[model samples]
Target: MPQVQRVPMRAVKNVVLIAHDSRKQDLLDWVKYNRPVLREHRLFATGTTGALVQAQTDLPVTRFKSGPLGGDQQVGAKIAEGELDVLVFFWDPLEPQPHDPDVKALLRIAVLYNIPTACNRATADFLVASSLFHGEYERIVEDHAAKRQAWLAGQGRR
Candidate 1:
């Protein structure tokens, strides 16, 4: 079995917020309502969403490129590098996105890394309200490199 690794998270988290065009207002409302709790953490978002968030909520957000322009990949990269702690993405399930693959990949990475992810308002609220969200926490994830090495070695024997 591949070994697992524990990544320690600080009390103040690095949170990334994302929303589809149709869901932007919903996300904004949630952010506005939770501004007090959210202000305690570092914020990040994709282009237009970030701008809107900053304007509406008066919160500072590190902006990446727009989703279709590769912002989802940028956020995924940060997750892989252990830079992002939480993900609050309000995606439109009924609407197909131009960058659907990127969105799927981002969600996959978040699950693989075992980070806290919230896909809607209710879940987002619960995530912030959880005791774990306010304190130091340790995330356990599979050691990917070790698993890859084992698979590679087995392939060579075939």
Candidate 2:
């Protein structure tokens, strides 16, 4: 079992936003509606979504490569690096993605890192409206280093 560590969150959050091609509009609508709350935080997004969000909301958005071209991996790396505070992904459940494995890996990394994530609009609303949104919050981080080392020792690789 992994151990838990309490970590403090900053008042201003670093948020990652992503969406499938078909769900981009939905994300846009949601963001626009939540702009008052979202605008206060640092925003990151995959290519076209970033551009559209910036254009429509007039809010600054940091852009990564398109998801199919490794944007998901970029976000995952940031999560591993402990740079992101939240993930708002509006993925299309009905549509198949060419980089499905990457998407799964991204979600897994988020879970492993104990980042706050919202998969749909309702959850997104809750995240944004929570008192922790504008104040300091503590998160329980799952520490898996000892588990990995143990497994490696059992495999005769440590």
Candidate 3:
């Protein structure tokens, strides 16, 4: 079994919000409804979405480039660097995006880093309602480098 490490998370989480063009309104609604809970955390979003979120909810959000212009990659990099704590991406599954690959990579990195991610309103609501969201918590993640090294050593013996 791979070894695991526990990463401590502070009560004030760094959360990134994302939404496709078709789903921006839905995400806005969710954000507005949860403004109070979100006010306790740092918020981030892509260009248009961030503008809309800020304008609508009056919440301060750090804005990145538009997703097609590399915003998703920026978010993915942050996740890999352990800077982001949560992800709320309300993407339109039925629509095709020019930056689909970037979106996939973003989701992949989120899973790799073991961040709490929500793809829809229901999941977002559940995440916010969870007891862990309001307090300090430890995230357990496998030590991938060690596992790779072990596998490489075993290969040399074969």
Candidate 4:
């Protein structure tokens, strides 16, 4: 039997922020209101949103390139590397994104890594208010395994 290596994701929290051009103002407002909670951990963002947040909040943010210009992929890579924990992306449903696949993959990686994510204000409230910043993020490796097993079982049933 081959040995399986488990890479422990660090306890550090990394929150990602993204919003469409239409939702930029909304994102800024959310950041302003939640600056105290948000400052407890590291922050990552794509270009314009990062610029906006940094200018207003004085929050130290690490910025990737523009999302359409491969920033989403960069964040996904960090997730894959077990470097990121939480994602607070405010995506606009009304707009069609040219980088939809990249965005979708980033979301999928978050799920795969058991990273917490919030796409809207309601979920964002739950995430930012939770004790995840002060302690460890709840990661369910068994959930991933169970879901895969269930999928295989259902396939056989079909």
TM-score, cand. 2: 0.93
Off by over 4 Å in 1: none
Off by over 4 Å in 3: none
Q: Candidate 2 on 38-130: residue-level lDDT in tens?
A: 989999999989999999999999999999999999999998887889999999899999999999999999998898999999999999999
lDDT of 3 by residue, 9-120 (tens): 8999999999999999999999999999999999999999999999999999999999999999999999888888999999989998999999999999999889999999
TM-score (all chains, Cα) for each model: 0.96, 0.93, 0.96, 0.81
The whole-model lDDT of each prediction reads 0.96, 0.92, 0.94, 0.81
**Residue 26 CA displacement from its true place in model 2, Å:** 0.7
Clashing pairs in 1: none
Query: Per-residue error at 146 for model 2, in Å?
Result: 1.5
Clashing pairs in 4: none
- The window of 10 residues in a row where model 3 has the poorest summed lDDT is 149-158
Clashing pairs in 3: none
Q: Which candidate is the best by lDDT?
A: 1
Candidates in descending lDDT order: 1, 3, 2, 4
Clash number for every model? Answer: 0, 0, 0, 0
Superposed on all Cα atoms, model 3 deviates from the true structure by an RMSD in Å of 1.5
Q: Worst 10-residue stretch by lDDT in candidate 4?
A: 1-10
TM-score of 1: 0.96
